[model samples]
Target: MRGRDEESGEFFSPSRSQNRRDALEVLALGEKLVALTEAQLAKLPIPDSLLPHIRDCRRITAHIAHKRQLAYLAKQMRREDDDVLDAIRDALDEDGEAARREVAAMHRVEAWRERLLADGDAALAQLLDEYPTADRQHLRALVRGAVDERNKNKPPRQFRELYRELRELIVGGSAGTDEEDADNVED
Candidate 1:
């Protein structure tokens, strides 16, 4: 008295296949967004108004994906015990708060970077004047690496270290030595 067919050796669930297709579509959409962003950034006289919108879209996408992952994990929790569901809910709440804090910090960093870019040569010249010993190439590398990590959805450990090193080099006016006195800081 077996229900499944033996010769075909196939499962007959339609919903499962649909779910996989939906996941593939979402992945494709993400790829398209990345490509679009790159193309939009390359245009001359870049539309200043669009930058904030682009950044906002990226943030919203990140937050939505995070929430979706949490929801999926919660849904997969064993239903035998109510306590497991409650724990998952609590954990998700905590994660949401942490994510909000991270987003706020990221926005601050983005604003500072935008300001630096807007200030143009004067800002760069001031940095050079303030930190004569620091290498501009190193500063650029650190900034680029930090941005790349942010774009790749990776942890910020190395990026943070690079940023700190760049900051130290700028503030201390020394490239090799990591010593920085607190008194000279203007920021």
Candidate 2:
């Protein structure tokens, strides 16, 4: 319905359009929250009051129930501070990136393990050169045990150990200390 006409002014329901936009935005947030895993949700900075709404949405499996829960969540979300939503989105994005990096690191470690197993001494020498502090004798024993286990078609106990050691040596060892050393150098 037109409200009033003032000197060629057109009447429109701007509030209705704004309400629809707000509802859509809130529903989008509800969708994102619903897609998040429990662990991810824990990381988000959501307030205690909103947790039940979010959890209820997650628990509702029926399509209609889920839709109703989502509507409730959207209404609740509209009452929250904008920063809370921003924080939740940021945390989820950060967690996603962290998970991706972890997967990539695992794949890289696996590739290195395979290379070390296939190339034997050549790869060992490369590993030693790269990680001077690595225990050569221990590594050789693990590698030998891993090879024996493979040849015998036994459970990959030693193979798993070898991967663990390589991961500890290459990934865990390098992730720390070096950054601190760099910071020290600047002092």
Candidate 3:
């Protein structure tokens, strides 16, 4: 003999019963609505004031039907991987102008990136050569300083003092003076 829990009671089968009841009610209501004339349906309290809602429902139904037809056509056109590849190749061959334009656009982007890399690399290499003894931290600080200086000389706000401060911190370990400073000063 099987035992059921007292708390759960009846095995939670409300969904099946509720779904069937709801579907039957919907079918009956739909038949009733269909039998009513437009004027007769308009007399209904909610429908009388919400003509736009009724129109929107009709539009949604038509859109759903159109989408279903499109989906059926797409499903019917499904093919093997090789067949799809062949079809794509045939389509591309038929559109030679479009293929050429795509290739040209790709080449242009490649050329632009190559130019940017060349310019950036040249600038980075020059900065590295200038600070040959400097470590990675020093190099980053130097680049940051230069960018700050360039930004200050341009527009709304001044940045020369900020650049000088960062430059001093980079050369002289954030504490005070650098090793080279002591060597340069005569006793």
Give me the candidate number with maximum lDDT: 2
Q: Write the per-residue lDDT of candidate 1 for residues 1-187, one digit (tens) a residue.
A: 2245578966555466676675554444333333355554453222344344334445555667745543333233322244533332333343654455444444434443443445545554655675677677765666666667778978986567654554445423443332232222224
lDDT of 3 by residue, 1-187 (tens): 3355588765544566776665454344333433445675554432232344334343454667744533333233232243542433333353654465444443433332233234444544543453354354543444455455555665412233333433433343322333332332221
Model 2 local distance difference test score: 0.78
For model 1, what is the alpha-carbon lDDT of residue 158?
55
* Every model's TM-score: 0.27, 0.55, 0.22
Which prediction has more favorable TM-score, 2 or 3? Answer: 2
Candidate 1 clashing pairs, residues 3+ apart or interchain: none
lDDT per model vs. reference: 0.47, 0.78, 0.41
lDDT (Cα, tens digit) per residue for candidate 2, span 104-153: 56666677677777878887887787689999999888888888899999
Count of backbone clashes, every candidate in sequence? 0, 0, 0
Tell me the deviation in Å of residue 77 in model 3. 36
Error of 3 at 108 (Å): 90
RMSD (Cα, Å) for all candidates, in order, is 18.5, 7.7, 24.8
Off by over 4 Å in 2: 1-29, 35-52, 60-65, 74-100, 133-135, 176-187
- Provide the lDDT at 113 for model 3: 27
